[model samples]
Target chain A: MSKISRRRFMQISGSLVAAGAIPGAGLLTKSSFAAEPIKLGLLHSLTGTIAIAEAALVEAEKMAIDEINAAGGVLGRMIDPVVADGASDWPTFAEKTKQLLQRDKVAAIVGCYTSASRKAVLPVLKQSKGLLYYPTYYEGQEEDKHVIYTSQEATQSVISAIEWMAKQQGKTFFLVGSDYIYPRTCNKIAKPTVARLGGKVVGEEYAPLGHTEFSSIINKIKAAKPDWIYSTVVGGSNVAFYKQLKAAGLDGGKQKLLSTVVSENEIDGIGKENAVGYYACMGYFQSIKSPENEKFVKAIKAKYGQDRVVGDPMECAYNSVYLWKMAVEKAKSFDVDKVTAASSGIEFSAPEGKVTVHKTNHHVSKKVRIGRARADGQFDIVHESGVIEPNPFPKL
Target chain B: MTFRRGNQAPRRKAVIPAAISIEETFVTFGIFVMQLFNGLSLFTILLLMALGLAIVFGLMGVINMAHGEIMAMGAYTTYLTASFIEHHLPGLMGVYLFIAILLAFAVTFAFGYVLERGFIRWFYHRPLDTLLATWGLSLILQQTYRSVFGAQEVSVPLTTWLSGAWEPTETIQLPLNRIFIVALTILVTLGVWYILHKTRWGLRARAVTQNRAMSSAVGIDTNRVDALIFALGSGLAGIAGSVFTMVGSTNPGTGQLYIVDSFIVVVFGGVASLLGTAASSFLIAQMQTALEYLMSGSMAKVAILLLVITVLYFRPNGLFASKVRA
Candidate 1:
């Protein structure tokens, strides 16, 4: 080492301090910002109609953050989360995304439940050069560079479900969903897939969101007498749909109805007895028989309370945090571009088993599952499609 | 809640079956009959929901924004009752609903009494103030319910007797729960009518609304009458909430979904005419059921709401506006 005067050493240290290499605190936040907490934004509807589902998602994400901080955090820095309320409004999602990106300047955002909210946030994410780890299984029509979809896309979920139904069940499907962009788009793809698989889509209907009446649709379904009914009804309306379906004598044992939306959380709301005999497809289930999943469920319940149950999106929301942490570690920096680059082809040991970030599409490759809802408010895993690749724009 | 993959193609992992058996029959006639039945089903439920709002708004002249919350209280009460029965009276599972209904009424009745005494009574005669104040009360009640019974919806298990459908023919199936709701709606509607028209309490309620100071001078105990009428209205709403659990949800904001529709029903039926309320709900329900059968759910809803607006424009006093002294 070369000998240096005390005055010269002080000057170098002063310049380093001024440059913020050592942060504002003397020796606390050091290692070129490694010691400082990396701020991550968590956006979800904490209030309003969507809050019943989205609020729990926020809890799942926070649980991940708490777990990450408890263990050694990514890049040797504690993760600090900036929570934003989307308030179940699309414009609010855009506003919050802008605030999270431009104001708080979070390294990455993990949020949004509805596809509308995701679409609202997309433009803002791209413009701000921010990353969003969206956890919802949505109608995929884009491969955005600024978004990393942590859940399955249409091909990984809806197509796989329709294929299974066509093969094992009947050839006819009555496609139904809550009238929204996601449901309409899903049905659009589903109709083609059913045709491609040499199955007939007997009838298709879109009930308005929050619609509680389904008797007329059930009447149509009965008239159509399709082998399977593919439903995409979401939110509080699900309770009415399931209850009415059961009351109409079309139950799990007879009428083969499978929903892409209802999960353990929803089944809990729809009542186990009401959902019994129906089917749901997802990337994860609380009953997934895996040591990793068992641990995840146990740990989540231990923290969130045993009364609380985990669902596919909740698991994916939890996975988004870990996936982002892995990306940050792989890049060895929190730079947006670097994280995006390192995120490609990243593999995570999620509760849903091994989930991989697609090399190019920015979506994940995960297992697709179809489970029959049992009376115990849990799914009985009936079928599993081996890890399926994500395609944001599937050629029809 | 639902997702799809974007552009690109991949072979499905499953092997395609060479042939699939699909039934080609669609029972169009049976569907027509079912659509009419669905309208009746909707009418019964809507009437049950609107009955309480009609009474409260017609007699009190108070626009209660928290009416939904009061109903949610009933739903939560029913849920609590079901849980209790499941744990303690497992054998009574089949009839827990009846017990739950009575308990929901009593609980919400007490709650309504206190609410009117502490909160609503102060805002009497100031309709707009009641609207704003009750709106805040509704929010507070929602948060309170959220704290008490987590934010998640609490579902009440339907009894076996109420779970099945009565199928006269393979295609013509009527839900047992809806039938049950219909029977209950008729009984409650009649009971409410009897009380309002044939009872002394109803006369006092009517007198106070007609002339509060005059009724007070005539020794009606106008304040007590106001509290009782409001409590009775709340109890009815509670019953509506209990009935709603069979077909709808039970959450903190469960009240919100029905609030707008409830107001629409009351307004479209003249302000103080119960018969008008019943008639309007019937018309609205039948229209929705028919439109839904003929078109998309969204379009049906738009058409129904548009009809209500158009009618309101033509008859600002609603379909059965009274010619009584103003």
Candidate 2:
């Protein structure tokens, strides 16, 4: 309330400014004490058709961030996540990726569940020279310098699954899928693999995405009487397909069915009773017996509640964060080029055992496990392959 | 497209052998019969969905874009009811499906009644406004469902009685769920026919639809009739949703999948003619099911859309236009 002379006020204000600036300047000079949190963008569909699956990826990424921060932080800087919903729309994914990279200036992004969403964001990432750690098993033949694919490609998943199924079961196969780029491409890989393994594909069919009427397909399967059914159907359609299969009395006991896409999340939706005994091949399963997986599962359950199921994508998403951390540390900076260069041979003791980044393709090498679904909506690991190098482009 | 080729190559290779052998001919016959049943079931569902739209769009001239969301509400209702039965009355789980269907209809009926009074009434004559408004309502309702029930797809437990199929031959199997859906559709269609032709409300509704001024002058409360008709249409959609749970998982976005198909069914059929709705749905469903066997599902879908567009281009009034008092 008291008024002072202008010179006196100016002198006091200047000293106060200097007093604040000195400590701030000192703190800024310390390399580890920048005080600004390193932000990582998480672009996922939190609402829409894909939300059922992508929401879990977001949670897994957050859990990884929390665990990394708890373990003395990443490079002595706390990890901050910038989450944005793509709304299950492809263009929205591109827009959000740009916003995250350009506006939020996140060090790296871990996102995109669907291949379409990933494809949409790829151009933006390429333009911005940003790094994206994509974590979904997809059709192969794509390799990008700006992206690190943490999950399996078609060769590692669908082809491996087909080879294993043909060896284990009979050679004859029936292929069914949802009408989309991923399923169609996976089936394209599956057909030649089945043929190469001396197996004849009895029937192959595709239903439109979100198509619930699988009665005709089931009937076709019945007539064809294939030794095994390989389905790449995804999303809500999976629930209907499995349920209709069960209702038609064609279950695991009557006929063997294997999938590259079905996991704990899908089994949860299709109901355990319907999905039980079906085999799914993926890089990780929740029931993997490794101590690393045990701790990962425990931490996730503790954070997200016991009812939340962790599937391949979620585990891959978790692995991506740690992989990014390892790369950043190896590069000693968050620069995209440096991190990408340092990413080769970067290893993370993932929940699925050890996963190493391939030297050239920016894809990871990991073990593939075939798991049989249990009544509790968890997988029982049936077969595990030793670490297989990723093949982004495989000759048919 | 490569996958489509992959699918077709095997099919074509298989077909040559199928065409050559008499034994394969029997197998082909069995498959054809099974596909017929499949097409019938699809037709049944499409008919049920289009019935409500036929009444609302055909009779009331209101484009209820939220019709699918109303169906989703019914599906969620069944899911909740089944979950409740599972948790609280496991002993009655087998018999709970009937009760769930009834509850689905009633809940959606009341919801439609409220929706009519609150929002849809204002945009009665403005078709485009009603469409936009109902679409906005659908988004709101979808978000509401997501918030209330979570975005995850939920499935209703199948009763033990409905859990398996009826196999008449070694090669042919009929799913009990599809049969039940077909029967339910028939019963509902009959009931709807009886209501529209034999009841006082039907006569009033028909009069109002045909000549609104004359019906009003004759002391009929057109507003009340509109609400009842809308609610009835919504209730039918709820029934369709309840039946849908037998075949598919229910999610917040489940309704969107059916909206366009149902609209196609209603508009392709004459909007006001129930018979036209049934025939068109049957034709569309059968053609789609048959074409899907010959080509990729997307290509089949493209074919169906083109067919529908061509048909509409020729007959904008629909397959069977009813003459109303002008």
Candidate 3:
């Protein structure tokens, strides 16, 4: 009983014409609405002390997501990355993880560079039932249902490297590390392993974190005359330790230094002259020769730039993204429970080599490589192990 | 797995014998000498850092929380100088360090002078306010350094002359950098001593410290003295930063690491007393190095802090309290 106004009639006719122009408009609209992108969280410290190591991981993760999206994404849904900065603070990590899981409703998260930050966010992720893909060689003795460790544990990293060094270098070992949970735990594992390998631990010393003066420790090393120096020193201290070591005539060639933490990224800070001959053991090295690695290294360098060097952490982070996608595709759903269950035994042809998630612990079994640093800031792979099982709680 | 089982039984026995042999006198003597040198090197750096803090906190009665950041400014200056020299005049790289030190001092001096005139002058009488203000200033400076230099730690390349160690004995090898730092500390200390005791500006500064009203009445221009003294203190901190680059890496947060230790040295040395600062630095450094040699680093720090508290409890005024009229 009402007359349609001229503007109202125009609006109604315009919509009607647009709708009629497309066939099956109602069904088409519903299908397009259902094709929303899957949200995934990327939490990393973009600022603060740890950012030096973490920024590269973020870039690598982005690269993996891009690669997956290019290949039509997982289960026909594109990944929508929600990046958050942890700021190198532990509590901030927990807060960001909660926001990512509850607010953003991300299906999965791939982040946390330090053990402290990981431990801080573990409870939150468990409460939310969100999955986290942690990518770093950690001092092990930790396992959680909500997390998957993509890197080597203490057994695969510290124990394996020590045993190899003792066999190759000599029976006398000197242990030095920065005073913190990771280094302390690493030394705790190394101490017993050194004894079991029929080696003598000549000296064990720890400097406060950020402690630069290593003359005393270097002096003790000289006096002890240890055949091999097993170092777990991290951060800025590494530059001072290595430079002072070289200055004090304790070059790797003379003392045979081996570290569990130093990689290609660290060599940039320590300088080629200081780090060149030293040995580092990790799951991945840039110089690793494999079809998978070649493709990965090329893709990362091509995308990020040629000057960007891929380190152990970066490789593991990139692999974690792909592993998550594989698990999601296998599970056939974005539900956290399904993805977590399917995650077990999910194998990815990681840049390092073939890496498979252990059925029970959610830790990946990976090949550990011992690489001698070259003058060009790249590692020369000296020894590569077969697929070593992830032993989070080593009997030692 | 095979080695794990076979090694379990003998591990305990092997550790016990090794632990006993570590107590051998020859090894102990070598360790003692090494720790002493280590302690001396630590003391040298602490003294350089604390000397400036002593002047500012002791004489000015203004709690300068940004003392460490001023030192960081010096370090960054040195870094820039080295980078410039490395790129432009590679042939003069060996002699660049001396020039870098001077530039560090000048840059920090100008910075401190401007800071005092613009911000610090108003909060001189309010210790708590000055503390908060300077703390804020410290953070601002730290962030500024982070933005300008990027957060990653950078190290100055050691000149050819300072690259190696001088080994006097098979058991002892002294790093040339440490020796240089020690020598630099002594020279700076002597220079500071001469300025505070022998110079006209030093007399005016001391007078102002004792009686501000009387000094102003006598035409001393107490304001000028305060600004210059603050600038000098900051310049000394810059020198400390310059020397630190030879031993450690420089970053935005590097200054924060040493600020607490510098304050400890200053307070334990009786605040304004230069001699007290030197003595306390030596004592604390020795205690830390010796304790660290015996126990864990954290435990050593805790033990030394406890010892300092106990010592301070008995002598509330510090190690060498100067007699001054209220």
* TM (chain A) per model: 0.92, 0.94, 0.93
DockQ of each: 0.53, 0.56, 0.38
Question: What clash pairs does model 3 have?
Answer: none
Cα lDDT tens digits, model 3, B1-326, are: 69788879787888877776744656667667767888998899889989888888888877999998999999999989999999999988989999999999999998888888889999977989999999999988987887787666666777878877787765556778888989999999999999999999899999999898999999999888999989999999999998887777677777877799988888888866888999999999888877776676767889989988987999876898887532
**Model 3 chain B poorest 10 in a row by lDDT:** B22-31
Top TM-score prediction, candidate number: 2
Question: On a 0 to 100 scale, what is the lDDT of residue A81 in model 3?
Answer: 92
Question: How much is the lDDT of residue B5 in candidate 3?
Answer: 83
Give residue B226's error in model 2 in angstroms: 0.9
> Residues A1-396, candidate 2, lDDT per residue (tens digit)?
978999999999999999999998887787555646899999999888888788889999999999999897777889999999999999999999999999999999999988889999999999988999999888878999999999999888887788789888588999999987887788888888888889999998989889887877787787888999999998888989999999888987788999999988778778888988899999999999989999999999899787878889999999999999999999989999999999999999998999999999999999999999888888888889878899988877
Docking class of 1: medium
Q: Rate the local accuracy (lDDT) of all candidates.
A: 0.88, 0.90, 0.87
Over A1-396, each residue of candidate 3 has an lDDT whose tens digit, in order, gives 889999999999999998886778776776775667899999998777787678779889999999999998889889989999998899999999999999999999999989999999999998999999999999989999899999999888888888888778568999999988888888889989988989999998888887776766776787788988889999888888998898777876676888999988778767667777899999999998889999999998898778767889999999999999999999998899999999999999888889999999989998898999887888888888888999888776
The i-RMS of every model, in angstroms, reads 1.3, 1.4, 2.3
RMSD in Å for model 1: 9.0
Estimated TM-score per prediction? 0.90, 0.93, 0.90
